[model samples]
Target: MISKAEAKHIWVLAEQKKGKVANVALEAIGLARKLASASSQEVWAVLLGQDVGGLAEGLIQSGADVVLVVEHPKLDTFRDDPYVDVLAHLAENHKPAVFLIGANSAGRSLAPRLATKLRAGLAADCVELSWDAGNLVAVRPMYGGNVLATVTCPEARPQMATLRPKASPRPVLDASRKGRVEKVDLGGLQIRDRVKLLESVETGGGEVKLEEADIIVSGGRGMGGPERFAVVKALADAFKGAMGASRAAVDAGWVPYAHQVGQTGKTVSPKVYIACGISGAIQHLAGMRSSEIIVAINKNPDAPIFKVATFGIAGDLFEVVPLLTEAVKKEMS
Candidate 1:
């Protein structure tokens, strides 16, 4: 076992795609900054991509004390084997005290493999993170978001955890903040390029990320059919927010699975979450109950959703949603 003295800085894997950094990556940096301040440690942001050296400055402004940029042709796009091999190499060399990764699609796939490579303990999908006397305490939701269980890696050298998207505050950008940027070359590094990317498709039509949206309008089985999603989209567009759907809607083929919001889908903590025709099952609530304000519109007043909604309207969403949309448009105009 590696001693505590061997581990030094806190590392955040800055996830980027097509030259744009993800919000969750910045959020992880922000959380890392908080932890670093408490422990008197430096925060390192590791960026891996081809020709992504230019994006290093933005990461410094977001509060990284050091930025490690690893460029490679194979890393131009995300593939599991290559990413895992590179990250594991870095972690083995650096031996950071804590390693934080965003609990997104790519992160979920990458974290476990990297952790296994380093023989480190992993806490997945943690809603909160803190330092507990040289140990990293991760608070993760359990029993379908009804319980929060705290986990710690007391014996592990690098305490690794995956932070859930939108669960923490975004770092404020400050251009004046300066930091060190180092280029890590892929010298003699034989990466395992098992997965080949023949083509890339944009199935969601480049829609706004549900986790980053300030407001979200979601529908459930109560939306009736696929056609009724138009009402949900209208409200979402009116607010310039993203549209979401419950698992029932997605399972019924009323909408794409990308719009699903629930335990089995995506977790969202928007400023406002409007549920139309949703019955509010526990599974669905587990994903979005963290929204600042919840508005539920359903004919059933006794729906489990009303129990958590800030405001509840018991009526037909067809008639009510159209009126609500018109009212919002009128008010905005």
Candidate 2:
């Protein structure tokens, strides 16, 4: 526990999309609450976006003791310059013991920059976070998911970490819990960058992000061709899960980058992950190795995916997936 003389708080950078709170924000707050309790500190959430007042209530309900809202018209959409500048300023001002962000696209882009600006150590894609006698310890995968590394930022103030989405449990709603809302003014420090968002295109039915999905059905090179994705999609549909792909498939242009799951792609921690026709490269396992249950289906019995799979089927995925999908559909009906 931190000494009484040293004040400590858990600060989470709450993310918003289309003026609404992102699910990753809630998950971060939930994990922050747990870390706060262990360190005998308070959990505070910081929101940066235009007209973000509506998001404060949800943050409180998600276990934040105080919601620090930084509302600026420039923050309405995600721009790297303004968001990073504001977050760095807030971290310096608040001087929280620990600062956390989601390991999603936005967070991944901003976290390392914020850490550089603050001159603080940061552990990225952390699956677990805890306080070891007042020192913030972050647990992250290393060596292509072959080993787990526990890191500590004892020398840095506002010890920073980014948690992978779905790596932690979602926070329970506590409607009765009340929290303070402090609004920060972002005045002259806004920096303009060259990148500008002209238009945003939504894809894949805008389904739940693979990182946040409870169930994911992933395809690989062995899937044969992009057309064969239908078999994988059918299984995902039957399970109401999101579809994903190995980096090999994405690089081969067999699937969109959004669907890729590997070291170079999205980190996911789903309840159940079904890998179809995937050999499970080390880079790919780095992303989804934390899944609660991994099911692998591949024609090759010697595929590397079977090593990490909780259940393995040594058969053609094309044959197996359709049968499994039909069985699931029948059960659901």
Q: What's the TM-score of each model vs. the native?
A: 0.96, 0.92
lDDT of 2 by residue, 1-333 (tens): 222234369999889989777787789899999989897889999998888888899899999999999888778788788888888877766677888998878898999988898887899988888878878889988876788899998766778898888877888999999999998876677566557789988887778678778899999999888899999988998988899999889989989998999898877889999999889888899888989999999998999999999999999788889999999999988
Candidate 1 C-alpha lDDT tens digits along 24-92: 999999999999999999999999999999999999999999999999999988888999999988887
Which residue pairs does candidate 1 place in steric collision? Answer: none
lDDT of 1: 0.92
Tally clashes: model 1.
0
lDDT of each: 0.92, 0.86
Task: Name model 2 segments beyond 4 Å from true.
Answer: 1-7, 187-194
Looking at model 2, residue 31 earns an lDDT score of 90
> What stretches of model 1 exceed 4 Å from their correct place?
330-333
Name the 10 consecutive residues with the lowest summed lDDT in model 1. 200-209
In the predicted model 2, the residue pairs found to clash are: none
